[model samples]
Target: MVNIRRIGLVATLCASVLSLPAYAQQYRFNYSKLYTQMKNNLEEGHPDVKVAFFFQEHKTSRLCKIDKAWMEKDKHYEEFVIPPSQELIVPLDDNLRQVGPLVYVNAEQGKTCDFSMVVMTKQPLSGEVSYQDIEQLLPQMSKMLDDLGGMFSSWFAPKVIGLTFEFDGVKQSAIQTSKGNTFSIDNGKAKVNLADLSKNESLLLPQTTFRVLPLLEK
Candidate 1:
C-alpha cells in the first residue's frame, strides 16, 4: 500500500521548489571584460556620445494608501527612475532588477509599475544601425567569446530578454524568448535585433550612468 504521508510530503516539496523565482538561477557572465569591450566599441564609434542606464519603479495606489496623507503630500508618481552607472549589471529578468534604494511615488495609480532598463545615449546615434549592422558586429562579439574559449559556453548559455535603445529621446526596443533567435522590435524606428546584440557579451556601455529608485511599503 502507498504511504499517504510520504506522498503528501513529496507534493509539498515539489510545490515549494516550483514556486521559487526564475531569476534565482545564478546566471554568471564576464561582467568586467564585457564592460571593457562595450566601452571600447562606443568610444571607437560614437566618441562624443554618453550612455545612461536606468530601471523604472512601479507601485500601485492601493499600496500608497497605507501612507495616504504622506504620499499625497509628497506628490509622488507611480513610475520613476533608477538611473544608470557602470557598476550596474543589467538584470536578465526585469523584475529581478529591483535591488534598491526605493522611493515612494504616486504615478499611474492602481496599477503595477513594470520596471525595465532603459539604455539611452546623451546624443542620438549618428545613424540607425539595423540587423545587418548587428550581423556585421557579430564576428567581433563571437571573436570575444572565442577568446574566452569553450569554458564559457560549457558552463551555460546566456539568455537576453531584450534591449531598448533611445535615439534623440525616441525609444526603440527588441524582445526575444529563450526558445529561439528571432526577436521583435517596437516602434520600428530602430532596426536592431536582440539576438545579434546578445552575441556580444562585451557590449556593456557607451559611458553608462545610473540613478536610484524609491521604495514603497504595502
Candidate 2:
C-alpha cells in the first residue's frame, strides 16, 4: 500500500525545492556585472558611454538630514541624500567613481534599510545592448530596483521604465509595455520599425538610454 503521509511530505519537499529558483529570480540583480560591462564599453571607446546611478531617500528618514547622528561616522552617507530623479554620473574609467553598494538607516524605526542601485547608460549601443542583453541582466537589475523601492514604498516589482536608442540621429524610445515582457516603441518619424530592430537583434542598441524601474507586480 502507498504511504499517503510519506507521499504528501515528498510532494511538499518537491514544491519547496521548485520554488527556490523563483525566489532567487525575484531578488538577484547583479551590480558587479553591470559595472564590469560599463567599464569594458568605456575602455573600448564606445561613444558617449555615460552611466547614471539613481538613489531614493525617504522624506522623514534621519539619514536624509544633513546633520544626522549616523552621518558623523559614515563618510559616504551624503551620497544617499541625492534626489531620486537626479542622476549621479559615473566615470566608467575611474575606479573611484564607479558604482557600489550603499546602506542607509531609518532612525524612527531603528531599522536599517538597504538600497539596490539602478543604473542608466546612454550611448551608441546598437550591437552592444538588446533585449537579450537586458534579459540576461534583468534578473539582477529587477532585484536591485525592487530593493530600492522597498526602502520607502510597501509595494514594488521589477520593471523597465524607459529605453531609447538613437539611430542615425532619429531617437526611438520604448513607449509601452506588453505583458511585462515585450515593449513597443515610439519610432519618431523613422521609416524603420524600432520593434523590428529589437526583434532582429534581441538586444538593445549601443549608445542607448534605458531606465530600470520598479514594477507593481512580478
Candidate 3:
C-alpha cells in the first residue's frame, strides 16, 4: 500500500531564476538549524531510524508533484521509476549538508514516517540497502537505488503525532499520520496530484531556488 501524508505547504514561492549562467553553479542552503530540528524530531519520533535522500527523475517532470505530495501526506510515501540520481541513507549528526537526495524516517503519533525528496539534476544512481543490517553480505550492498524513487510512510494503530521539520522559526513540515500513508509531493509542486503532474522531473512551471551556502570555511 502507498501511504501518503499531508503537512500543508512549507516551501513558498521565493525568487526564481529563469536560467542558470553558462557556468552552472551549485547553490547551497545553510540548513544547520533545520538539521538540528530534524534530529530532535527524529529522536522523539524516529528513534533509531535512519534518514536519507534520493534524486528526482529526469525529463519527465515529476519532482514538483512529489514535493507537493510530501507536504500534504502523513507518511509521504510513493514509488516511481528511477531517473539517474542516487539515494543516500545519511548518518545522524549536526555536520551534514545537502547531498544527492535527502530523506528522513521517524515515528509520529505512533506511526512510521519515511520521506525521500531532493532537488538535484536527474542522473544515474547507485547504492541502497534495507535498514536491517545484513552482516553476512556486507560486500553485496550498493549505496544507490536505480530506476525507482520510493518513499514509504506507514502508521500503526496507536494514535500519535508524527515528526516534523521546522525552518526559520516556522513549522514548515509536519507528519500527521494515520493508520496508513496519507499525503504526497512530486514535480516540485506541493498541493498537486500524481496524475496532475508529469512523469518526469524536468523543469515544468519553474525551478524552485534553494540558495545553498558553503559553510566549510566558516
Candidate 4:
C-alpha cells in the first residue's frame, strides 16, 4: 500500500511538471529580428538620424566606449552602427547573443533626434512589478506578446523599473520627454525614476542625444 502511494505521488509530480506552460521557454532574444525592427523604425521615423547599439557594463563608473578590436574580431561585429545613408545591418555574434545593448541615437549639431525605444530583457525582475504608471500598460503589452510571440514581444515584455538617459556630444544636455517635462543629463548621464515620467510613454527627443539604461534584476 505504501509503495503504491509513493508511485502515485511521483506520477502526479511528473504530470504537473509536464503541464507547465511552454510560453516562458519560447521567449528569447532574436538579435536579427530586433535589429531589423529598430532599423526600420529609425529609417521611417527619423530619416536624418544615425544610431549605435552596444552593451554597457552597469558597474562601470566611467563612460562606455566601443573597442575597435572587439568590433572587428572574428569578422563579427560586437557593436552595431546604423546609418540612414544606406541599409546597414550587422549580425550579432554569439558573445553578445542574449544581452540587450544600449542604443545611442545621434542628432546633428544643435538639433534634437526624436525617437522611441523599446526596453528588452530576458532576466527575471529583481522585485515586484508594482509601478502604477506602467501597470496600466501591462495588459496591452501582454496581448502584444501573445500576438507577436517572441519576435517583437522581447521589446516590451520586460518590466521597466528605472530609466537612465546619457548624452555625450554636448556639454549641457537638455533632455525632454513626450510629456513636455525637461531634465538635464549631468556628466553625460541622467538617472530618472519611471514613477516620475508616468505621463510619458516614450524616451528620446530633439536638441539632445542620450543612451538608454533600463533597470533589471540583479
Candidate 5:
C-alpha cells in the first residue's frame, strides 16, 4: 500500500514539473550566428590582418610561446579565434572564467592592427538578471578586458573604440549612455559607444548577460 501511494505522488510531481513554462527553462544564446558574423566582418574589414596563437599562463598577463610539449599534454586551451585576425572571445563566468586566444598582431610597414575582446557568460543566462549578478559580472568583465589590454605591446597603441552586447532582451531607454550617446537595440542586440570600463565601472542594468565585443583600435 505504501509503495502504491509513493508511486502516485511521484507521478503527480512529474506532471507538475513538465507543465512549467518555457521561460523557466534555460535561455539559449546563439553563439554560432554571432561567431559567423564576427568572422565575416573581420575578413571584409581586415584583409591584411595577421594572426598567431600563444599560450598564456593562468592569472598572468604575459603570453608565452606554445611549445610542442604543451600540445601533447593538451594544455593549450583555445577559447575562440576569429580567422585572419588574432582576436579572442572569452567565456565570462563568475566562478570559472577562461581567458585565451591572445591577439598577436604583425602589422605591415605603415599600417596598424586592430581587434576586439569578446567577454561572454559560460552558462545560459536567465531572461532576467538580478542586480547582484550584474554588479558581480561588471568587475569581472572589466578586469578581463584590462588584462587583455595589458598583454598588448606598447607600440600597438591599443584604444577602446566601442562595445556591443548580445543578449535576449532590450534595455535601451532604461540605460543611460553618456552625452551624445545613443542606445540602440534591434533583435536582442544592443551597443554602447563606451570603453575602458575599468576606469569608470558604471553599471548598465537588466542586460542579464553579454558577449562583450569591444572594438579596439590603434
Candidate 6:
C-alpha cells in the first residue's frame, strides 16, 4: 500500500492516526480551589501590608453567572463561571501603562473576595525627583500624605490628591493626606498661609534647594 502520510510520521504508521487532533486539552477551572490558592499565596508573601481589592468589571468580567432551567416543574440549576487565567491589570505609571499577571477570583464573597493579585515589585517614586538634594525632605512629603489622608477621613477624598507649596521652584505636585487642608504649591511655594504656618517662631528656611516644606504647627 502507498503510505500517503508525512515522511517521518509514515514510518510510525502516521503516528497512530494523528492521535485525535494532538489532544487539545481544555482546562476546566475549579474556581473555588483557585480562589483559595491565590489568596493564601498572597497572604504568605506579604504579611505587613493589608491588601484590599475590588473588581473593575463586576458581573461582566469575572463574576459571570449562567442560569439553566430543566423540563421539570419549577426546576432549574444555576452556576457562575469564568475562563481560566483571565487577565488582571493595574496602571503602573502616570502614563497609564498597564501590566499584569491575571487570574479569576471569587468576587461573590464581597470584601473577602479572592482577588487575582498582580503584585508589582517596585515603582520609581515620582515628585521626589532629585529629592536627595534634600533627602530630609521626605518627612515633609510624608506629612503631606498623612495630612491628606486625614483630610479624606472627613470627606470623600480622591485616590489621587495633591497639595503644593509654591517656592522659587514650584514643587508642583499632588499630595495625598488624611487631613482635609491639603497644601498647595502655587506661585513657587507650598500654598500655605504664613500665619497658619507659625505665629511662634521663625522658619529657618533651608537654602540648599528651592522647594519649601510645610512649617511645623506650633
Which candidate number maximizes TM-score?
4
Candidate order by decreasing TM-score: 4, 2, 5, 1, 3, 6
Q: Which lDDT tens digits does candidate 2 get at residues 167-209?
A: 3333455423222333433433111223334533544232333
Model 4 agreement with the true structure over 2-110: per-residue lDDT tens digits? 0111000000111101111321111112353445334432323222222323322234433223221112224444444543321223453444434533222222222
Candidate 2 Cα outliers beyond 4 Å, as residue runs:
1-87, 90-118, 121-124, 128-131, 151-155, 158-169, 172-201, 204-218
Model 3 residue 188 lDDT? 24
lDDT of 6: 0.26
Model 6 root-mean-square deviation? 22.8
Error of 2 at 199 (Å): 9.3
Over the stretch 111-185, how does candidate 1's per-residue lDDT look in tens digits? Answer: 332222222233332333344433443333333222222345423423222233322223344333233333333
Candidate 5: segments with Cα more than 4 A from true spot:
1-117, 151-164, 167-184, 191-218
Judging by TM-score, tell me the better candidate of 3 and 4.
4
Question: What's the true lDDT of residue 124 in model 4?
Answer: 21
Report the number of the highest-lDDT candidate: 4
Per-model TM-score, in order, reads: 0.24, 0.28, 0.23, 0.31, 0.27, 0.17
lDDT string, candidate 6, 46-158, tens digits: 33211112222333323211111111112332232332222222222222112212222233222221222221111212342222322333233333223323434224322
> What local distance difference test score does each model get?
0.26, 0.30, 0.23, 0.34, 0.31, 0.26
lDDT of 5: 0.31
Model 3: how far is 114 from its true place, Å? 18
Candidate 5, residues 70-120, lDDT tens digits: the string is: 001134433333332222333333222122222122222222112112333
> Among all windows of ten consecutive residues in candidate 6, which has the lowest summed lDDT?
6-15
- By lDDT, the better pick of 1 and 5 is 5
Q: Candidate 3's C-alpha lDDT?
A: 0.23
